[model samples]
Target: MKAGLSLVACVLVAGGLGAAQDYSVVLPTVDVEGISEQDFTKGYVAPSNVEVNKNGLSIKETPQSIEAVDVQKNRNYGTNDLSSILEGNSGVDASYDTRGDGIKIRGFSVDGGDIYRDGVRDSGQIRRSTANIERVEILKGPASILYGRSQGGGVINLVSKKANFSPLYKLSARAGSWDRYGGMVDVNHVISDTFAVRLTGDYEQGKSWRDGVKYRNKMISPSFVVTNQDGTVSFEAQYTYDDAWRVPDRNPEKSVYDAMGISYNKGFAHNGDFVKDTLHFLRTELNAELVHDINLKWIAGYRKASQDFDNFFAGTYDVNTRMLTQNYAAQQTDNTTLSSTVLLNREFEGERVGHKVSFGYDYSIEKREPRLKYQRGFTASIDPFASSSSWNSARYDRVSTHNKHKAITHGVFIDDLITFDERYHLLIGGRYDWYEFKSTDINQNSRSYKDGAFSPRIGVLYDITPEHTLYASYSKSFAPYGGNGWVGVSTTTNDIQNLAKKQTNEQYEVGLKSEWANKRFMSTVAVYEIRHKNNRYNPDSNDPYLWAQRDEKSRGIELNLLGELAKGVYMRSSVGYMSAKTSGDEVYGYRNGLELENTTHWQGNVFLRYAYNDLWYLEGGVTAYSKRYHYVYNDAAKSAKGAHLPGFVRVDMSAGYKFSKHASMTLAVNNLFDKEYWRSSSRPGDRRSFMSTFVYEF
Candidate 1:
């Protein structure tokens, strides 16, 4: 693949070099803050400038559906973690399962392996701390060209806080219902004109609505930077360590309404719950201006993490006896990840055209070891209303080594954006990746497999005006099979045999982006169709082993509106509708066009904030979703029709007051109406939790 790319590069460069060089202009860059602070972040909207794309084209010139949010601003609007941050964006639904954070984009669930930090892939089940985050970007549609081997749903890019050459200090404390309490410290010091350092830390402890569920967590991040006065060269190092002990939340159960025609034990806690996790990561980077029109940058990162869990909320239910039978399970993991990347960016000018070119290579190595154990007799059964729901792990003698695996991936990608007189933009990019996986079973024997893919993307953007643009794009994406689906880890042969090929998907999208009132308002609407292959499922073949199939499809429309709505008023809202279904051959006698499980056909949200005075403000939001199916339909078998989750609407409200120039207080109420809504099949959302925060900055 490397040799083939080199040949292709030679031809592209040779062909373009023949053109006469007769112009000079400033180089385009991917600096999210380059556009003036007010334009980049004001009101409730963030800038169109993004660093996720290799080319620094604004969102209007990217020819794709995209969303971004300013963490600080969203914090006032009840945003937390990647999922909540995306609530104001179209076609995104965030949820939490026994795992950690999960998200659905355009009818596709993005696996943990597809999440990214900065420009590198992450291999840990992260809960996502906001202490070190500045902003996040959701790059919609096919993004493999920039992200390497990944799902077709797109990638979530987090931009961490950077050290600034100035003095900054902030302190904040928060307390809320369910005994929630936390505090944060953020400090930045300019030791010298050429060197600066920043440290951010947070600590929290809380009890949940569920009985016996409690959590304690702490995180500390320190970043340092060194640069010459000329700003032509710089070096940075960032480090973080997080520790947490949490009582796992109870899982959702079959609502009594389904069986007894009434809600019973609907929000009951059903777990012996415990989970402990720790993570450490270090990232180093270097940036240099190599020539008058060329630059270089590189990043090296390492991460180590572990999780220990015992007693979760998984059990079997006996409807007739109105009883629950339970089991005690314990699990743990030890993992290490190493990655590095080097990128070169250059700019050239022609009489009426220009180019922004980028080339990069990245490699990653990951290793994991896991242990599992179970005690079947610990908690044999619990009466539906039993008061004693305890399990005894001391009775279990031996822990088993279930599985351990490692993976290595190498990728090389190149991107180029050709600007024609600054009106029409043509972008092209592609990447080649080679991935290998090896896993070991309890018997100490291991198996290995290898696969690769070539992802390509191209788009065109036309500017009707500086604030209005129209564009279209088509991209290719693929994900290697045998991925554990948890942090891009390795999968064992017992889980997926052969694993010879990868699932592939292609996307075609067209959209319009517009802005008004000097960047104070922005709106975007996009229509897209995605055709996916290798979405395997056995067609109810009663055989001991079944082969995978490859046909699934989805189409959708997304709309996002943000920025100022009226005088001293700001609003952010989004809506999405999609039809995702199985195609071609029937599965388990289901119709070829049955809707996929857990996918909603309609989802939308709106949040608005109004500034009453320099010292007072108010914000409120509403989130809604249409019915979602929980199972696949047996279309040919009328007796096995699928069931759907009823649609729901939720509301939240907040108010704030600035008592002084350096101090402010805010109060927020979630589930303002105390609506009893389920986030998934069995997990009900928190009901009317109140939070109060006080912040001081200098």
Candidate 2:
């Protein structure tokens, strides 16, 4: 695990080795002029067209380190939601969990890979919120050979928002600073030339900079499409619903020297200010595609996702008695997910040796249930309306377990892309998966486990001209573990039967992709090495725990830049050098173990944009973090190393105007100067926030 590779060859020789600049600095100049007279030219489209080319479902073609977040660049940089539009790029990072929207790519988290939409499978597996996105694709490394069981860190595809034949309409609204608010409406209708209809809706509310945080959310998505006439056959249906509410743990723990609060403890300020929970989710998707131009093709899909969660917080905190509390804890949850997919696309040698073949099948099912409650003599000084059912109910804790988890997966895949005379090319793929798990508790007693796996991938492309391309690839992956949620509770600690082994990964890559001068801009450079095996740490089995097996390794180097470095200035940047270890672990028993926590060595992002004539636009950006270590102890007073968490820089600015072409307005400033950070290892990251937005178009 230590492929910092001389720190990525010292940041590409300080951004000067193998030179890759098309332009950087020297900006200003508006006017798109028919957007450069488009005739198909904009970052690799055609992964089945629908504006394709975002990296064409990546996996190889320069094999790893892919990033994309361009849906009109997330609306000219207002970049609302989805964690600041995926903030920095490269290997990505955007922390804040414990129910505050999570994202941690590369260093794992975000439920370890494979979250898709548009390529199916996007139930968001719990703790959710993504407002029916329309862009965001990241495939860094070890993609379980393209979505099988996941987690060698790499994969995130949320591209939903389609249905635009022509006629369109849009409406947007946002207001910020604490009492936040939101609005959105996007509709596209072309009920003719083959039919189409797309609708999107959104709503939001806020108040959580710190004191008794608050939140509210709503989302609705609708879609239907029908097209057939030379363009293959297409039929689609979609429905999404989301509702959210929060106010848990209600941060508010100021106590550095204490005097600033003369009133002593303000610890449990929730009761009247915040302390709530609610969540609901529903989804349905159905798709079908049959393209018959004789090149052979077929695709099918179906999905159903459901979720419900209700929780009540505040368990106990007195700090100094500046408050009163009793009756703590509550939870109720239910989840369901089902998925299916089938695909086939073919063309085998004939037409000057440009062979292509693809076949795929997938299935997923999940179910979960959780219910826990304990409340006794609740009393935060009663008064302001009591009666949480007069409190008192606490007993269930013989481990108070409840389980209902079921998972099944079946997969078959084959891919081959060969083009020998076009300038040497070859792509290969293989997949086979059969996994199953079933459990039923709460006395209903039942258990089951099954497994089968295989995955492989390979790629090579060298066109070197006609627009540069040099690539390399190798991939393999398999990760399965009853499907998440394993924090041991029965069967003598760290249970789940030895963590159900089935985790393996391998990835090696090299890259270069280019477009010079005429293509308007594009660049990429990648290097990667990834490894993981066994990785099932189970012990503490019902207490004194004692079960172990582990493995890990992650390596990196990536740099990416995107288009239009001229003409009203447009830019995007990425810099990354990652390190993750634990290769061959055995801690306490002496083995490979060291590294993991905050996971970073270097991370970066830079964005610059400007516009003046469509009535003005402006943008600025910078993001950085470096410094790792937060846990893994060998007794430094109970084990702690490199307790460093200081290395952060943020700057953001925004401006927008266009009071005509159908109205517009925008204003933003985030952390502009009020820098204060702590992306949640327990909350604190919201210093300078401000936003204003409005728009309408037809």
Q: Whose TM-score is greatest here?
A: 1
**lDDT tens digits by residue: candidate 1, 222-333:** 9888765555666778898888777776543555435533243233344545777787888877666655566666678898878787764545567888766655567788
Instruction: Estimate TM-scores for all models.
Output: 0.87, 0.31
TM-score of 2: 0.31
Error of 1 at 288 (Å): 1.5
Clashes of each: 2, 15
lDDT of each: 0.70, 0.56
lDDT of 2 at 593: 58
* lDDT of the structure predicted as candidate 2: 0.56
Error of 1 at 109 (Å): 2.2
Candidate 2 lDDT tens digits, 1-698: 14334433443343342123231210000011112111112222212112111212332344455676654344333334565567556666665544434565666555423566555545433445566655566776765544677666776766666554656677888887878878888887888876778888888877755545567778787766654442233445666676666555333222221322422112233343332323332333222222221121122334443333333333334456434343433445455555555454555466677766666666666555655443344334322122334433332233244666666677877777788888888888878888776766678777677878888889888888868778888888777752233311233334566666677877887888776578666777887777777766532322223456677777788777766677767667788887777666554334355665556667787877676356766778888777544543453344444444556778878777777778777787877897765553434456787778787877
